[model samples]
Each structure stands twice: as C-alpha cells, then as structure tokens.
Target: MSEILFITREPFAIQGNSRPALHIMPDAVYALVVTDPSLDFEENRAEPGYGTLLYKAPASSDSSDEETTGQTTLHRFAFTRKDLRSTCTEAPVVLKLLEIAKKLKAHVLSDYGALYFRDENGLVNVTEDAQAKSYIMGDKGTRYALTPDGALADPASLPAYLAENDFSFLPETQAEPRAEQPQHSEKPEKPQANSHAPAAPDYCKGMGTLKCSLFSRAYQKNVQLSINAYYAWCLSFLSGINCGYQDFPEQMLRYPIYPSTSNEDIAFLNAYCTRNPDDPFISACLALRTMRLERQ
Candidate 1:
C-alpha cells in the first residue's frame, strides 16, 4: 500500500548507456537519484552549457558519512549491476530483484512491460501488450490467457483465479502416452528378485514414459530445490522397482500418466504424491502388486 521500493535501469540521454539504480524515500516523500561512482556523467553532457549533478553511491562503505553530506543527501546504501550480479548466485538480475522484492514485501517499477513476482503459489507474471487495453497474466507457456479492462492488471485477483483453477485444467481426454521401445545392451543389470514378480499394473496400459520437459519448467519455478534434485527425487521412486533406466527390458515402465490421462486422473496422481511425499510411486506400485497377488 505504501510507496513500494523500486529497482530500475535508467537510460542516459547523452552517454548511450543505462545504469541500474534503487528508488526509495530514505527520509522524504521525493526520490533521490543515486548512481555508480565510476560513471563520469559530467563529461557526456548533451550541450557544453548544460550540466547535471548526481549523487555518487559510496564506493566502499555505505555506513560512511562521505556520501551523506547535505540536506539533499539520501540513504547511503546503493548497488550497481555488477554488485547485484555478483552477490545473487541464485538467479539473474530481474529474477533476483523479484526475489528481493518478494522478501521485502515491496514492488518493482519497470518499463519492460512484464512484471514478475514470487507469490505464495510461486512465480507470477503480469505482462502488458501494445494494444491499449491488453494485458496477460501468467507465464509464457501458460494456457490461461487473462485480459483485463486496463493496461495494468491487478495481481491481487490472481489468488481467486488460482483458487478456482489450480495451475492447469486438463481436458476430458488425452492421447495415450506411447511407450519408448526398450533398448538392448550386451551387459545389463538384472532386475531385482522381487521386482519382476509384480507385473506392470492395468493402469499402465500404454508404454509408460515421462518426458523430461514435464520437470524442466517445474524445476525452474521451484524454489525449494535445484531442478536436478527434483528430477533425482522423481527417478528415486523407481530405483527399487527395476522399471526405469535399467537392464530389464520386459519390465520397462513409464510414469503412469499418459497423454490420454484425464485432468482428474493427473490431479489425483498429484494429490497422491502430495499426500504420500515419502514414497508415492512405491506405494502405488506395491498396492498394485498386492492386488495382483490377492487375485492369484
């Protein structure tokens, strides 16, 4: 509600360069300009008679009094692109700014048209198009297209939309996922003694395999762990089953979901995984195997 903090790259009229700056009301209602100490803006003035003055951010210590001289002086701490780029190892500039803004409960001002922020539901984007009253809510690959009345769309309404439609909506029918043909090698790891007894379940009708792309985007948006970690966790579910990348050809299994998997079914699998975080696949597979044994 209050004037949110903003980080932006300001374009220079004369120098043909853009510099990153932090916008804040350190003590007053008006914003004060701060720039890198290394940039010599005075030399690049548009006219010989025209000159502009700027506050140079302290080179070494922000706590130092040198940069905070007069009534015009603003808060001492300021950062350059290099400073931010080096410090934020987690992500690139814009993404890192979104991370900081989210943490501080602040907003970023931008002319780039798209505003990305981290929310309770993960990363969200509010983008503006060239059309007068055109806007988009959500990411690039998102199927949901939201166009509001004005150029700027309120992100506050996103939660309600999320409540109504969590992430994606699956159609009534999906194509059956085709299974990858088994590859043969001269030397292969033998299936575990118990793994072979449990034949693929009825639920696994088609050649069951999952594409790496499913996890790729999910990995990027995930904050808890690296993409590799998520991928590894997904694969870990099959380690004991002798289903995935292993020597056993006949027992090769794909993720139970296929192109034909209904939205409800996919949601169910997601819910099952969420409920049984420790071992969803193993539990499902074990249950199927038990059912088969019971029938025998």
Candidate 2:
C-alpha cells in the first residue's frame, strides 16, 4: 500500500558494513514492507541497492571492469556503500541494516557460499548488476540497500549488530528456491547431483553458478513435460523459427509455452469478460463479494 512510514529513529549506516547483515533488519523498513496499500512505484524498484525503494532503473552505465584480488579473480564494479545508502528517504532503516550486518560478521558472498558462481564467460564475475543485487539481497529481509564487496570490509561490525537485534526470515523464504547449493559437496568438481554419471540436460551444465542455482534445482525435478493445445501452438512457433513468412494469426494468451497465449484463449477471455462485465475471474469474484451482502 502507498503509505508513508515514520521510523522511530532516522536510519543511516557507517561507511563500511556487510550487505547481507544490513538486509536482515526489522528496523530497516523496506518500501515493500511498510506500505499498507502499496504505492504505484514503491514495489518496482529497479537494479537493486537503493534503487529498491523506487523503480527508476537507470540502465547500468557500468563497464565490466576486470579486477584480480588474486584467487580466482572476476569482473566487478567498484562502488562505495555510503553512496548507495543515501538514495533512500529514511536514514535510520539504512543504519539499522548496516548495524545488523556488522553484528552478523557475515560476508554476503562467502557466508552465503555464492561467491564462486561462474557466468557464461567462465569468470566468477561479481560486477554484474544481477550479481550485485544477489549479494545485496543475500541477507534475509524484505528490503535492502547495499553494494558488492560491501560485506567483505567489515565482518567484525556484524557481531555487534546481531547482539542488539533479533531478526527473522519471511514466510515466503521457506519456498524451495531453485539455486541453493550445498556448502561443500563431495563433487564440488561436478555440477549435477551425479558427477560420475554420463550427464542430463545441457542446461544442467550451468548449475554450478549462483545465477542458475534456482533454475538448476527446478530442472532437477520440478518441471513436468506435457503437451496441450497451447503446447502445439508453442511448437508451431518453434517450428516456424526457420520457416518463411506465413499468415498465421498470433494468439493473445500464452497458448503455447514460454511465449504463452493463444488466439483461442484470448478470444475465450474476451468473451467471458464481455458476458461477466468484470473482465477477469478475479474481478468477477471481487464484484460478487462486493455485492454479496447488498443483494441480501
């Protein structure tokens, strides 16, 4: 909900602190957490960091600067933690998150064991926007404002923060995430569950990186393969990849697969909405509830 939240104290952080520790604080009011009705732009914060509060994502002007901290080096941007925190309206919340990280003594990437993920380039790159966001949000919390390598500089501060505050993870956190890898695997050298085995899907090869973790877990067993009319349409689109132009009318709903939507499904939806007036089942249901007592 679009509601302004007044913090008991202003939130701000010292210059150096860990990203994960800062993310887990209750005093750190997330734009998503504090709003009762949720404003239009509050939920759409773009590109991580302080950008989490507002949605305007200035396209990453960052170049992939390669840096070697010696062991297994990667490309990552260099930015200060203080600069990122100032983007938020509230200072106390930001300070609280920083304090939490300082007390936890947790290294956002190392504690989470996500530092080693390699991207398509075979580099354990940390400068990528996605990588930065992952580390910033690595700590358990709804809202966050942190930067890459922000945690490495200040592990000692985290313990003190943990001593003062008691924090908990969100319920949605229990959902089986696709990307969590075991801390130390017998086959850390191998990607899939069975290293000795021949292999599984080609996509499985990307499993070692943190980016593919969630997807890897899902690919292991969650997704079921089946065919339906939508599947047929999807196949048709796939089959048309190399084909010459044909006058096939595109469907509206995902009638197929990834690019779902069928002309038929769209037609059905439109017809259903026209008859019911509310346009969708959700709207129809809401209308029903709104009028339920009125009719009586």
The digit string of per-residue lDDT tens for model 2 on 220-283 reads 3434231133224333433443253244322111222233333222222222223323122332
Off by over 4 Å in 2: 1-35, 38-160, 164-296
Query: What is the C-alpha local distance difference test score of candidate 2?
Result: 0.27
Tens digits of per-residue lDDT for model 1 on 99-197? Answer: 434322234443343344545666544434333213222211122222342211344654443433221112111122557535554665554322212
lDDT of 2 at 287: 22
Q: lDDT (0-100) at residue 28 of candidate 1?
A: 9
Name the lDDT value of residue 164 in candidate 1.
30
Name the candidate that leads on TM-score. 1
Q: TM-score for each prediction?
A: 0.19, 0.17
The 10-residue segment of model 2 with minimum total lDDT is 1-10
Best lDDT among the predictions, by candidate number: 1
